[model samples]
Target: MARSLSKPARTSLLPWLGLAFVIILCDQLTKIAILRVFSYGESVSLTSFFNLVLVYNLGAAFSFLASAGGWQRWALTALGLGAALVIIYMLQRHGTQRLFCTALAFILGGALGNVIDRLAYGHVIDFLDFHLNAWHFPAFNLADSAITLGAILLIFDELRRVRHGSR
Candidate 1:
């Protein structure tokens, strides 16, 4: 016999999706503003350790395989899209778990945000540079920030679950 899906499960997914959409909107809007305001490679110091800059990433995190002769563009885009699908499925299955679903929602937003950039410009737009006395971290944008936060939350959630002896 086939089991039926519940209405609550369907409704529960909406809030997570809405959160993802908000992240996507904020990511894109910030990118657009940066694109309009900064020329390529331009940097403006915002603090002792922060700057607003413009850069494009053609590959995954930390520019991994970024110089792989352009094939990484579509490959990374496909990877992001695939990850989004899996995250959504997980969100549907675990929607009642607030921390887990929130983490997935953030990741989903970030993935789609980067995916949008890849499709529109063939690269991801990155800014928000942080540095210290000539040593610089890689430049990244809001979407990257969201993804990182989500990953951290996922780890924390797992730790909490383990401590509580819950699966």
Candidate 2:
């Protein structure tokens, strides 16, 4: 006969939560500074290939559904909040997975930042434009950056898991 083992200890998820909060804080603070300094549609050259611009995104990535009038505002806000809640739950469940948790943290922060923007200004504030020659990428902010990075990290983590034979 074998003795039964007790349950594993519950590890706190505060560190990951703190990282998300810090990302959100930085994203919002930068947006506030840009709002104070730049007028709408303002663009200032930051480098040969970059610019600091003020633009409002009433839609999602690449301005998807941006021309849908006022309805997208509420729709996007609800979507973002929903994503945040889901990411929080994922973080809670997989907090020990460092890369996965970190990615989720970033996504959570970015989603909340956009949600706050939607609530306060009815749109997302974007700056940091990049361009080359006649082509220009969409203007974006720190929150967008975080979300993009998170997505890339998620892909990398998935690849690593496959390589290591972990599901």
Candidate 3:
């Protein structure tokens, strides 16, 4: 049987795409601002809990596989592309579902933001840092925030679906 598009699908997808585009704009603008303002590895403590630390990550979060003599760059680039494709597919298929569409928008924005970084600089730019006395958390940026937010939204969406009998 052929599937038909519905009005609800158009409404949800349009806003999802708009949100993703807005996210991309914000992520890129912040990265550019940080690049122009901060020297690499420079840190400006904003509070006892946070700082803006400029750093480039040649690998994934926490610098995973960063020391693999550079092979991981290509590997990770490929992985990101694959994930982007999967996400786009999900957006196309489930864009009528409000929560699902929101999750996909976040993922799409984040994936594209990092992809732009890898292509332009061969690494991802990270600036946000949270720390305490001698302890530190990994620095990240808008793109990372979106990806994490997307994952959380996905979980919330699932829970909501279950509760609402939409499962």
Candidate 4:
């Protein structure tokens, strides 16, 4: 007979899911504040390199496929939802691996956050902007930030794993 996960093993995934939920909450709340305070294309200079701007992305990171004439909305939404499911599965299997699960949780939260935007408004709302003189980075939101951070953490985790000869 095959053994199943014990109760403690199954419950180990909860903390990571809770972290993802908190990230989603924070991402959505900030997006709400930005929507209430800024009109489309409106920008407020907050520092030498940062500004609060209002923009909607109909595409993925850096507005890729944003001009695909609307198919991207549902496509990205489906993709995000798919990724979230995989992340949850991975979290359940590897919940005891701190760094790996943390990376997955962040990515899961950000992916769902953006997925919510796509489902609710047909686009992802982006407002955080950074620039240098004449060049500006693409505007993004808390969800995007979380995804980026998660990617970095994943890289670090892999490097550490490789260095330490642990799988």
Q: Please, what is the TM-score per model?
A: 0.93, 0.93, 0.89, 0.94
lDDT of 4 at 118: 99
State the local distance difference test value for candidate 4. 0.95
Ranking by lDDT: 4, 1, 2, 3
Give all candidates' CA lDDT scores: 0.94, 0.91, 0.86, 0.95
Candidate 2, after superposition: displacement of residue 84 in Å?
A: 0.8
lDDT of 4 by residue, 15-71 (tens): 999999999999999999999999999999999999999999999999999999999
Which prediction has more favorable lDDT, 2 or 3? 2
- What lDDT tens digits, residue by residue, belong to model 3 across residues 1-167? 98876533434356777888889899999999999999999999999999998999988989998777888778888888898788777777777777888888898898888888888898999999999987999999998999999999999989988898975
Q: Model 1 scores what on Cα lDDT?
A: 0.94
Off by over 4 Å in 4: 1-11
Pairs of colliding residues, candidate 2: none
What's model 2's TM-score? Answer: 0.93
Select the stronger candidate by lDDT from 1 and 4: 4
Tens digit of lDDT per residue, candidate 2, span 23-135? 99999999999999999999999788999999999999989999998999999999999998898878877778899889999998898888899999999999989999768
Q: Which 10-residue window in model 2 sums to the lowest lDDT?
A: 4-13
| Candidate with maximal lDDT | 4
